[model samples]
Target: MLFQIEDIITKMQDDKTGGVPIRTVKSFLSKIPSVVTGTDIVQWLMKNLSIEDPVEAIHLGSLIAAQGYIFPISDHVLTMKDDGTFYRFQAPYFWPSNCWEPENTDYAIYLCKRTMQNKARLELADYEAENLARLQRAFARKWEFIFMQAEAQVKIDRKKDKTERKILDSQERAFWDVHRPVPGCVNTTEMDIRKCRRLKNPQRVKKSVYGVTEESQSQSPVHIPSQPIRKTTKEDIRKQITFLNAQIDRHCLKMSKVAESLIAYTEQYVEYDPLITPAEPSNPWISDDVTLWDTEMSKEPSQQRVKRWGFSFDEVLKDQVGRDQFLRFLESEFSSENLRFWLAVQDLKKQPLQDVAKRVEEIWQEFLAPGAPSAINLDSHSYEITSQNVKDGGRYTFEDAQEHIYKLMKSDSYARFLRSNAYQDLLLAKKKRGPHAYTHTSCLRACVKKAQSQVNQQDDKCLELHLRKGDQGEYQPCVCLGIQGWSKSSKGKSLAGKRLTGLMQSS
Candidate 1:
């Protein structure tokens, strides 16, 4: 019955229906990756690799942009930029191959030639009959040239290897000639060969042949862990903003101090009409000798001082334009509205939550900073704000405001604070289990154990308390302010005993 149906199916099938021609699965697989344009290649590469390391991927990708399909990362993977133009800002890696027309793909042809020319020859994958014939001939011509050039290089490498192999005891250099797959180069893809041949075809094997042997059983796969943390959420944004605020404080203080120092240095070098006095709020001392005061002012400072830091401002009044240039710069960088918001809540050790909320809203009205109550980020979903502004002792609670800010951050795709390296690192590291996508739990566990064994160089006192473990799984290590007390007391033998007991209980 099966034979009869098969016979009818084959005979009656239209070109488009009933049954497809019997071609190997490899044929379909080969067609899957589409050619991509240089721009599309870059965009796809950016998406595929870690966004945090976009620039790193671009370094390798640019080669494909320069020469389409000339260099393959591996035999299974091909890269090409559309129109075969090397472009600035194009990421050449991980592009779909079909979007590009694969005509003139000299890079791939060059590689084929280089392979055939070398003593270490490789098989070329056959394609269409006519094209394949042309490619094979082209490949043979290049291959001959590559092998001739490589003969000289091979002799040099072998001589060098013979001298160094005694010290290194590595068989790698002796086994294969590792060269870039460029025309006229001896090249090999040993790592890729291992990868391509790593697994057996399960369909051909009727039973668990791997389990039958002790050697096979011993070769249990030990997975390498990728970064565990993959996605970021509102909680992650809050953590990011908390870190940003700390950075803002540090940056602002440093900026203000530098601004003042620069102003003092500038007034001495550039004549400021004697009106821009370095000394302000001074009771001018009357020297016993008027000549002494005159002499002190006349002689320039003992050393040449370079005042390149920035301008200075003693005070900034919105109405006073000239004196407040420095303040204006600061205001431009960190808006006046943000200043108002900070001023509203900064001084008091405690403030009414409602009042704080109102002040933040007022600031939001003046400026469009991320995570503000009235913040209208282009990326954010619009939500109505209450009419009442945040006041010093207003009705909304601090926790409520914090949650609102967090929600605002989550809704906006382009929120700067969330995308900052520090936050994204933390977020992605959490998603991938560690820093890379392939990171697994065991690698992380090993890292935790290793970190626990290491000494904390921060203190000369107790070491045990200073021992920090990466979160039992993938959370990043951060020194908590609360660790001081525990770290301070870890020197005692009693602490070691407690640690042992805790470990036992945990186990």
Candidate 2:
């Protein structure tokens, strides 16, 4: 559609009759060159396309302008209006039909060149200024190169005639307007969602009986007669039926295996799932408590949490306590280099682009170099790949080696770590604490009693309160006399009872 409209626009730019009047429009202080009025464009569209409605012609003109065949002289918006607003035809080289997909570097250079120019007409817009700043940060390492190219282009542009320069600048701006339209404007260069999906996962092309592709067949100059369709025979039908039965059987077997795997995984992790199995100390979000989070952050791991480490190597590494235990186990086995190498590779991925080369070299020297102090084993294929990658000095220089070591540790070292005494000791310690040892009520009671003892040591006459189990299995307040004699007045007893109740509730 864009190509078809551009062709019509090309004909409309002709100097002969039927073309829109192209002239210089003199404003207050400046002359706009090679421009046509929006009214003239709409009238030409209505006359040449034989459209009876003026509204339809204006609509068509707006579509053409949005596609960047032409643009208004003084607006960032690319829309046609039925008025005397001046518009210019974009240069043929800048037309969307040319398939110009400018990269960020090109845009950055153009914006940089605009900054160097002193003319107000070439000044960057607010959004363009923001884009330039972002591009500078993104391409920081090569910004010097981009600036040099922009300078060279600016020098060349300076030698062009004043009128030609104005036209060229407007054309370039319109080209970018189509590619990176204003925030509210429709971006004409954006592909349809369906087209993007088709590009990502295209269907296989059909091939002819001669093994030529359908596209090639259509483009071929030689004429070929179509072959008659062959009739299906009973033997072919039987073969197809047998093949389909086999496929069904295989599919059923695959589904059954998948179902079993899912069931096993659920059973293994059911205890760890807070929703299915109630969390110890209650869920924080539901109960308005942070006990569960506090327990996880503590140095000691719970028995259930430690047990989850056996489920997967990733599970073990994800838990800080479990990871520390595994590291100790590896150190005892003198194979800690594998874990260290894997950690270094992970960190390398996060390094900035300018620092990647330095980090990559350091990682290679420490992990993969021959006779290195803490070298780990790697297969010949991975070692060779790592060697080549190290020469390139990229962030993933040891990706293959890291992956190999990870699988080795997960299959061998991780299994042994689960059975090691260090991990079993942690699980046993947590198990001995049991569910009753650290109940919330017991901890609160202990804190209240400790406060009571501190007060008694300071003032021996201070009242004390004790919490006792009630009939409903909840804590009830009970007054305990201090070292002083009890008051005999009814008012004194009532005040003491109220104080006891307050202490119990606060605890």
Candidate 3:
């Protein structure tokens, strides 16, 4: 698409009347040469491309400018404006059609040359200056060589005519503008990964569409094959058969191992599986009762819930109570930094984009840097990768380090935690109240029925004895007296009922 658009732009440049009017513009002190107004470019695009909307034409012009076909003469930003903004055609040599893959060395030399020039127009932008500093540190070993090359280029550039130098400098800047564009500008030079792979390993094209032989097309001398093709022998066939047999055996062994792992996992968790074993307090989905969920969320978890933590390290970390217990265990062993670093990395992934860099730096300083307050042990490879990634301060800067710490905790600390007395005691501790324990509403209903049975039998002693345990406060005195109302005379019963009602309301 870019190449085709560049062809159209070339035609537009060549046309005299229906094309962009190119001319030199005299500024306050100097002449801006071979530049066209952005308005002229937009008008030409709308006329030739049959585009009705001026905005569309301007957008097309911007796309062409972004691809380095044209650029603003005075700005690092490669964009087209539908006003009097001056844009100059980029040199054909620097066009993306040439597959210009500029390297860091070339970029460094260009930046260095800009620094040598005392012209105000050649001053680097803030981002460019920062990039130059970083490149210098990266290529410190070859700094002398790079400096010499930049000095040589600057000397040659000075020899050119002033107008010619201005054109050349702007063209070179535009090339970099397309490659390492301004921070927000789109980098048009970035190729698709699929296209890059195709370029690496291109498929052969058939020369003749009609399937004609190459020898018939042009009478050339026939050449012998580079290497002699040999027929397959019995030994080769037998070797292939043996290789196939070995592959089958290996596949079978892998299948057996997978089956064994699945069986072991199923056995370990079968008791906790709601489908295999009925839920202790009934599954909420199957029954309307939410006793199972309530039990799981309780401050003092049930034995079954605690037992699930022992099934895997992930399970232990997943449960709040279990994770707190594990953290305590880690603190006792003075290795809580591993879990802390792991959790910090997890949290870093969820941070807002604006806060990600700050949080990344905090995590690195707290757990990964040299002499860090709570440094966790990391292998040399992970440490090196993390150290390099910390410079960017991205969200995933600690991915490798986090993975290493997680594995360390799972293999060492998690196993030890499960075996620790703290965890074992929790798993063995009997729950004071089970899910089916009597609630206050249920107890109240049972007491009411017992009192009614005693009242019908006219056994006041039995009713009082059952309702109140005298000073022990087994039941409320109001409830005990409330039942006496049913056994007394009509007047006594009315007085008793009023008294009980008052007591009940106050209580």
Candidate 4:
């Protein structure tokens, strides 16, 4: 039909025999018994080319208008409107916004130039759109083939080892049988195209013009010319089951080959060797069999503070209980002397001038002395400097010695302590306690207490009370001596208590 139209257009352009007039061209088109209606074009576009839906219809209409196609005055042709609802027409024939034709233009050359330019733009857009759609369809078919291959492999997996369901169920077999590629179609393996070998390109599969595979074309049951459609007999059912079984076998073979090839490729090309450094020898003193201590410190443990604290000397000083826990862990590693030396140095730092000399001497003997029973490992220079500092009792006494011990613990003992079973158990226990475990609603209680405790100082006989709100939101009263300098006094407490009591009672 396009060739026929182009042939007519070419004859109209010829000048040697005098070009065919517009009216003669119109007469020639009209003489054709089967004039292409909008419905026929739309149906061909949607059903044959698979371009359906309202949006596609609008796109086709816009392309036609831009390409300057003249729509004959008919019910079908008139319905084709631009997305903006404008009625378009051929050159020199104007249709205004109201969908009614105005006057024809006398300036035909100007109209011809405008229409040609619009056609050129629209042709480029149309070509790009067609290519893009074809590419999308190609990609869709490619993934479809991959998915089918994967599904076949899944069927093979189900039948492997005889332990994980040795046989496919009836429904599963039926599903795989339907998707199994026929002999001619099975020419393309996933690796073939993936390796950029165009052995069986998916583009050929997606394009209808290339023709469908033999199985798709021949799947329908044949009809005898002389007989009405024969009802399925026992023989036919047996044949179908046999065909399905054969298909299943073919699929299994295909997938098994693919799996074996993949395994072979992986074995041949993939290497698991990695560069690794030799591990350091384990310390003789740090035995894994050493027992852990369950010692509790004097201070109540603050789980929050422990979590927030860093692995530093200042953090250990701030949380005595966590520090104690860390020390116990280090004891299990046979490295507790590091912490002991650090703590001794810390204590010596604040010791009075009179006590500093004796305390420093004791610390040196215990942890810094050469051949000392509980001596901590340190560099020769550090050991000598520490010994000199202890004897001199200088400014920031034991400061350098403390830093040396701090680093020793931080590098070795502190790191080991964090990974120890004791520290892990502590972390587990804290996690079990959760955020609300240590929580108290002190603000509400303090508010009520302040409101009630504002009695005058002159009233010595007045009862001092401690109030607590139970879980039921009811206040319980108990007698207790008031602490000195309670901020809320008699005047404010009395006023606040009365207002709060009224509000609470009303609520």
Candidate 5:
């Protein structure tokens, strides 16, 4: 039996192409003056659409009412009521206070009108935002299902690659083969539609019409039948994989387009409103406070500070340490006199081989994790240890700085080398100009004491050589006698220097 109107289970409203694309009611409201009362909006919907159905009008009105006209989406117009529950608008600019005004609850209903146009325009905008979001969601779900199907197919392909172990596998295959003619009605229909490529075969595109051909003129118009597009095949899978590899081409294109469109919208919109500046927001529709800033300054390694005082909804990372970390790490790098030098110098590598921090991280995970390689056999890996490598000098990535750290912490010779990179600059300055370069008598003694011990353990005469290269840059080498060398060499330096000599001669 053919279906009639009474027999129809799904109407256009209920057809669920995901959801109906209703533009944000708030925007439409904004275009008009004010329509706080339900009746006014309901009337507008009726006059606007020539909608005959009372229920449909009521539904559309409810959509507007729910939005409460503050946000760009939904009924952002705040429908203030004395007693009402608070809920967030699915879009921007809406606050619960709009609907639930703090002191104004005496009236059963009150509509706020910043301006008459603000009310109408907001309703229309809300309508547009809602509809576009719904359209995007419907499309997004389609993409998601496609992705899931692709993932499942990959898993199936992986299973097919494994060898069958049982002796009766052929018998099992025969049984599966006999039943494999079917994939249920829905899946079979999908499978058929997929096989039909309008591009490859002309029959697939046969008189593309929304419904049955107009030639078959009849009383009722059939709803459009959309044939599903076919997915890529095994050959196409290779191309898809290649496409996935070029992520910048696919993902970035959409993102780049969106960014360009947004910029164009801003640039064009600025002429309409001169307040628009690259520095600050000019659009009344958009909020400047939409984005938050990290105002909290927590830690100061410069001074001792404690943990966990300030991560809040309005702002997070408040402690001095948190704010200072980025600055201090950038400023006070010990390796180079200035941090900008490393930043200003360009390296052609995607991530340079010479970037000690990155290389060390790779070497740490790749080479050292398996246990420090026997020094004799370590050269087989592709990561070459080149002399060009520079000290990372970045404190932020200290934990991630793989081998540079491992060599510092591990090898006896390297411990001295690690301890030594600091001293050679001062010492080099010293031998060239006699000894006035010393700034800290106390800290220098402690450093030299540590270096002396590390050098003494190994016998290459450990002559306190300056600058040997490896995972890190050539260190400013200085000697120490620790459980290996002497502590006094750095502290009581020259007993009395030429400054004292001059004083003695004067006396």
Candidate 6:
């Protein structure tokens, strides 16, 4: 496709009389999907080996425009005679003339045919032939008109007048012969074509007065050749099959060489040896050291409990199963209304202002009102204020209700939640079977076994806790929040032991 366009452009620029008309070039380009503009044609040409010099490229571009292959049009302006205002307007088309005929279309078609013969592959040859056929058809449609135009141009060239050369002699004669002429005055006809200071198409005598010939008026019309359609034969089909088979064989040989090279390349660079290591490989089950839970184990029980539940708010929101279990626990205690209201208020806050009022009314009717379907325990005064607020609800009208619900859950429902069996079971299950737990439990077993073997090296001042065997036959270590001064006093040791025992039993 690219070579075909370059061929057309080369033929066009090589024309001595500028180049083909703009519409003829456009019509040729319309057959190909790739060529769009004169610049596209030039840039494609510049990449070719033949168009190496910058001067040739510059010359080709100049010919494309100067030869009427591309014509530029400007905006038309209108002005008000009364005022100084002017208006610029655009027309649908800017084409001032219709000259679609090309002077050397036969040479362009010959270039395309020569390009097809240069290609080695049958498919490419057929493609170029089809493109040439299309161009031929385009020419055939306007052949009669093009022939007439060429004939007209030929006649015009043949009848070139010497009026400009005779201007001085005609003017002198008219000056001496015209009636009532001022000195050196010449009639309009006496002036040459260059200096004709007369109205355009001035009145003239009939053709008989000038002795014009009847043969020129009765000249024969041009005859255009008819395009023929060729039918396919069996020999042509067999020839195409032979070409395709040869192409396939050539492609297969190239692919075989490529595959052999790839195999040799891989064998040269790739390592295929077995993996060998020095130590008993560290357990793959052990995890990286980042933990969401607070791992600073020495804090007081009350403080630890606060951190766990505070962090659990995000956990519950993130973990769908945990949230569902929490909601179920709230349902068991008949306080699910608090969670429901909180969730609805969260959704309401995200809604548009127009939607918030409707959502506020729904929440009040469904959960906040006295004897409502899932009524929450609100005081009578709070209930009345909330109902009135819902009636006059703006975007933030639900704020007070959401806050009241949040406080109720954190103080009453959330406190009970921590003590619920569902909450304790979640912690136990996560500590035992979770991915992090699998690694954590493995680490603890290793640490405990190592501690037992090096009992003599164990610091006596440190609080020592007992080790217990888990269901998987791995010894789990009792992790103590390293409390200072506890192992020094008997009372402190007793209290620490009790707290450590409770923590182990709870987990």
Best by TM-score: 2
Clashing pairs for predicted structure model 4, backbone only: 454-489, 454-490, 455-490
lDDT, each prediction: 0.34, 0.74, 0.74, 0.44, 0.30, 0.44
Model 3 CA lDDT for position 250? 60
* Model 1 agreement with the true structure over 1-507: per-residue lDDT tens digits: 323323332332234543222221223423212122344444544554444465554554543323322222223222333333322211222122212211222323333333333332133333322343454444443433434444543454457643242222111111111212233433332235466367433322111211122221111122211111336578767856676666566634578889998887776446433345432112236322232343245322111111111122112222132213322333544533333333333322144434555555554454344455533322232222222223333323122333344353334321343334543444454443322211235545665564455323343243332223343332443322222222224455344334443543353
Candidate 3 residue-wise lDDT, 117-158, digit = tens: 888999999999889877776665566677787898889889
lDDT of 5 by residue, 183-302 (tens): 221111123445434434322322211122323322112222222246546875674556555653543357888999888767644633545444221232453332112112212121
Candidate 4 TM-score, true structure as reference: 0.28
Ranked by lDDT, the better of candidates 3 and 5 is 3
- Alpha-carbon shift of residue 302 in model 6 (angstroms): 22
| lDDT score for residue 102 of model 2 | 56
Q: Write the per-residue lDDT of candidate 6 for residues 14-113, one digit (tens) a residue.
A: 4364442222122342321111243443444466436876567646654433322222211011111112111111111211122111122432223232
lDDT preference between candidates 5 and 6, better one: 6
Better of 1 and 4 by TM-score: 4
Q: List, residue by residue over 1-507, the lDDT tens digit for candidate 2.
A: 776897789779876857998999887998888999999999898898899899998999999999998899889899999999999998877776555545666677778888888888888899997788677767656776777878888788889998999898888888888878888899987777677556632222222321222322231122112222355578767856676666566634578899999999999988778779877768777775576787777787767888788788999878777778888899999999888888888889778768999998888778778878898899999999889767768655676788899999999999888788888888887665444223366566784565455431334466554554433364444445543222234354444445444544553
Residue pairs in candidate 3 whose N, alpha carbon or C atoms collide under 3 angstroms: none
Least well predicted 10-residue stretch by lDDT in candidate 1? 301-310
Better of 2 and 4 by lDDT: 2
Could you list the CA RMSD of all candidates, in the order they appear? 33.6, 14.4, 16.3, 30.9, 27.5, 34.3
| TM-score against native, each model | 0.14, 0.44, 0.41, 0.28, 0.18, 0.28
Of the two candidates 3 and 6, the one with more favorable TM-score, higher being better, is 3
Model 1: residues >4 Å from true position, as ranges?
A: 1-282, 285-323, 327-361, 364-507
**Number of colliding residue pairs in each model:** 43, 0, 0, 3, 65, 2
Please provide the root mean square deviation of candidate 5 (C-alpha atoms, Å). 27.5
